[model samples]
Target: MNHHDPLLEQLNQLISEGRNPDTLHIDTASTLDIVTAINTEDHKVAPAVAACLPDIARAVDYIADALQNGGRLIYTGAGTSGRLGILDAVECRPTFSVPDTLVVGVIAGGKTAIEHAVEGAEDDHGQGALDLADIRLSAHDVVVGLSASGRTPYVTGALAYARQTGCKTIGVACSPNTPVLQAADVAICPLVGPEALTGSTRMKSGTAQKLVLNMLSTATMIKQGKTYQNLMVDVNATNHKLKARARRIVMQATDCDEATATDALQQADQQAKLAILLVLTGLDVESARTLLSQQNGYLRHALKAHC
Candidate 1:
């Protein structure tokens, strides 16, 4: 190892890298006991995230504003952090009926890094910015940088470049007062403390990142009218299972029978929100679609406006 590496010093100061006093005996503990110990630490994740709800909500506002203005939401990270971002981005399409280009994920080392560890990828800060540039990042986009340790060079670099481009930037990390947090317009650092295995951020840090990303994306989509009450009104019926779900959602939204929901779904081309509007308002497809369009796809708003 290079003794002069600055990251070494930086990592040494990170709370995510410190050993857990509570899990010291985890190595020799029974399997159940080991898992129990892990579970105990896992329980700490939610409250930590709860403490940062303000900043997380603020980040959501930035993302929602960007999306409303026709900009995209982009997440950049490395390792476990990167994979989590990709998971969230991919889910948005099926869950909210969004296009592929709307929510984007960029992992360090490009596509290969998503599956295999690309040596020195996260350390290449310049590549982080380059990756954003390659994606044609604009001021209208929101770039969210995810890093468990809160000091991943790649994430920090991406945040810096995003800021320079006048892009709305958000940093999600598990440690407090680190570069990842410092580089962005909004800092959402949920201090999940030390990992159970010490320096293995894939545990608590990964959990924290997932939780924060969940809120960041889910809340933003909700604000953008992807949901009607608690139902996924905008869900895309892209597959057999999703098609069934879309029908069920319409039924639940309008309290109609399966046949009625199915009929409306067919009329609305399997769009759950539109199907609900058709079922409840007894409107033709064209009128229901026009109302939804007038309300910017907000189902409840469209219903209220028509009523």
Candidate 2:
């Protein structure tokens, strides 16, 4: 029974592949030239992500089902990987009305490392297990382990621990044949070739991970009824800016004028989906709220039920 992983060998191959994308030679070139080159490289991210869309969608579907059944979406990673996971988790609250506890982010060095790296944190496999254990993981939870190299000790440890605890574990990596994938239930690897900079996974690899993270979180929200007809319906109006956006979203979705949308939004206590439901179905706030509840916040389903 050996824990030796083949991913480490593949990682060495990746390093030796000479696929650096970060060595942008912009000497004496216009600022726009540098920008254009960077943009061109960035453009490659989508296609890489597109190639793995099926896997991503599958992960999204599974995550949604788990979340619908009262599961948590937990992201685990280190360094750039950790930052991307944290960003995805935090954005869900403001973007899709997901509760903080519903989408949780756990970096290797904790929250403090979000801005500054903590020395040797990524090497702590024990810390990964401790983090998952501290969360009291359950079968309903979905753990996403992120690592560009796909062999990050911290990420592997987290996924391994999650699997042992009966949680649905997902591995998102940039390299092919990553051991992190083997340790998880679902694996999504977007092979983005090599970074422009030697051994700098933060280059193209980071972009690839970000794109996948965006898809995973956004698609899952769409499945959970946070979106209606390509419109974000679960946006949290936490501030004036968001409140205005919420009003605009409802107006656009319901095809109502500003005054009517504002009135309906107020009637629904600024709940975007409920407000849209009220406007579209001509139901009062209480009835609209009830229908939304009945449909589990799925506006489209509630509309079908009401209509």
Query: Which portions of model 1 show Cα errors greater than 4 Å?
Result: 1-5
Q: Report the C-alpha lDDT of model 2 over 1-307, residue by residue, as the tens digit.
A: 8686775555567632445545446455688886776676667778878888888878888899899899999999999999999999999999998778999999999988999999999989989989989988888999999988887889999998898888888999877777787887788887766554556778778988888898889888888888999988888898999999999999899888999889988888888888999888888788888888989888899989987
Residue-by-residue lDDT tens digits, candidate 1, 1-307: 5568776777788899987999998999999999999999999999999999999888999999999999999999999999999999999999998999999999998889888999999998999999999999999999999999888899999999999999989998888898998898899888888988999988999999899888988999999999999999999998999999998899889889999999999999989999999998999999999999999999889999989
Top model number, TM-score: 1
RMSD of every prediction: 1.6, 3.8
Cα lDDT of candidate 1 equals 0.92
Q: How close is candidate 2 to the true structure, as a TM-score?
A: 0.91
Please report the TM-score between candidate 1 and the true structure: 0.97
What's the distance in Å from true for residue 31, model 2?
Answer: 5.5
Each candidate's lDDT (Cα)? 0.92, 0.85
Residue pairs that clash (backbone atoms under 3 angstroms), model 1: none
